[model samples]
Target: MDNATAKNIREGLKADCTKCFGLCCTALNIVASSDFPINKPAGIPCVNLQNDYGCQIHSHLRNKGFKGCTVFDCLGAGQVVSQVTFKGQSWRENPKIREKMFRVFPIMEQIYEMIAYTAEALSYDIPYALSDKLSAQLKEMQSLTKLDAEQLLSLDLVMYRLPLNKLLTETSKYIRESLIAKLPGTKNSKNYNHERADWIGKKLRGKDLRAINFRGAYLIAADMRNTDLRSVDFIGADLRDANLMGANLSTSMFLTQMQINSAKGDINTILPTHIERPSHWIN
Candidate 1:
């Protein structure tokens, strides 16, 4: 990356990080590994993390079993939720506020994901005339980052789209129509609302469903026996007690740290999200 590009990325990271407190590492658990020494529970602190909220093993996280840490990018998501929303109080400092903290974290994560796409849009040199509107939207997003847990969850963030919806639509069309026009082997995939399905007892044994979108799918008590689900989208899926024996989700999309905490899976269950895989089960 060029210096300008690198600088921009750094600024983005700084802006976002200023609002976060490495909550992904602190609020979540990881199995014992060379990277993370202790297997902690959700709402519990890592053994190596300092009381001041800095990682005791920050320098050597990679040398430990935390090789996954290097690749995991909250994309400035963590910092934003941590500092901006919570007002500099970390979950570690106030254990009594765990539930509220956890609840808000995922919402902020979603907003950050949207911001990431917006940042990418900006980089393509969005029209100079529309630049002022984009700047205003960016400011609004930044302000939203400062909301508390309940406030964030209650706000209809979609409203921000009202001003730039048409512009963004045209911009997206330009990208898809111009840069991505007629690209070989680049077929756009379709999304399905396979919700409320009676997957109660059906055996989905060893299915190759990589990148399949399963948002809001009702998978209650489903027998997902060893499915290959890398990078699959599960944004709002209801997976209460879903059996995921030997299933691979190494590259799943929208599998936030909060959602994983809410779901039940064993070691044999492959997870694509960045949180540490729990250690209780064996493949």
Candidate 2:
């Protein structure tokens, strides 16, 4: 998907904490780390979560050593559970439903994430036959998000995501292969297939890495500064602390907000238009 598609999908799929009941703060397990200052169990609210379902230290979350909260995007699942599945009933107001609501929150998260990926896949200029198949799959998954809390809890997320992932993989091939054939001097897609690569802390700066498949790669803390990352597939790549300063990822495939949030960048780093540069990034 292009940057426009990314922006549009994100406008819809991005988190709206205002409409949520602090599901991410309450329902998910948290461990102490550089990302978080304390341990919090599942179904328990964070110390900073207010009674009105807002984070008391939201504006200063990173300053308060809660960097984990900043990178966690629910993909609009929190509101869907808060309003649709449970019908605006909060764990506090209806304590009886608290455990079940917590259980369904994660399930909804998976579904929403899958839906977001499918929507992104449909934005590609692939063949009509493939587009129709992707559209159908997208609709099917979208409908599942409207199911009741009981139904959502029972959903086999892994089973649903498996088939959708295959479709995404196919779409990735079509996108990368087409771009590979277009970029001058670049070899075939197979020549750059670095799928599941282990490149932790590897220095690869200022390289012409067009159309490379870095899917499922361990790119953690890798020095990728000023590299040409256009048409690179970042699906399931661990880019934590990766140095992306001055790099060009304007046409990268399968890139997500979470991935962008975790990595470092600068004003000169050209990102796909859909991703807003993080405030922590250097100017």
- TM-score per candidate, chains pooled: 0.47, 0.94
Instruction: Write down the lDDT of every candidate, Cα atoms only.
Output: 0.57, 0.86
lDDT of 1 by residue, 1-283 (tens): 2324422632364224335655666566577754355677765556665655566766666566554454345656676676666767777577766667876776676566555434434544446655555555655666777777789889776676555554544444443334333443354543322434445555677876554556567776667768876645565566655677788876554455434543456777877434455432243
Q: Name the candidate that leads on lDDT.
A: 2
Question: RMSD for each model, in Å, please?
Answer: 9.9, 2.2
* Tens digits of lDDT, candidate 2, 1-283: 3435644764478788899999999999999999999999999998999999888888999999999888888888999899998999999999999999999999889888888778777776888777777777877888998999888887888888888888988988988888878877746434789899999999999988878899999999999999999988999999999999999998888788889889989999998755778888899
Q: Once superposed on the true structure, which residue ranges of model 2 sit more than 4 Å away at CA?
A: 1-7, 186-190
User: Model 2 RMSD to the real structure?
Assistant: 2.2
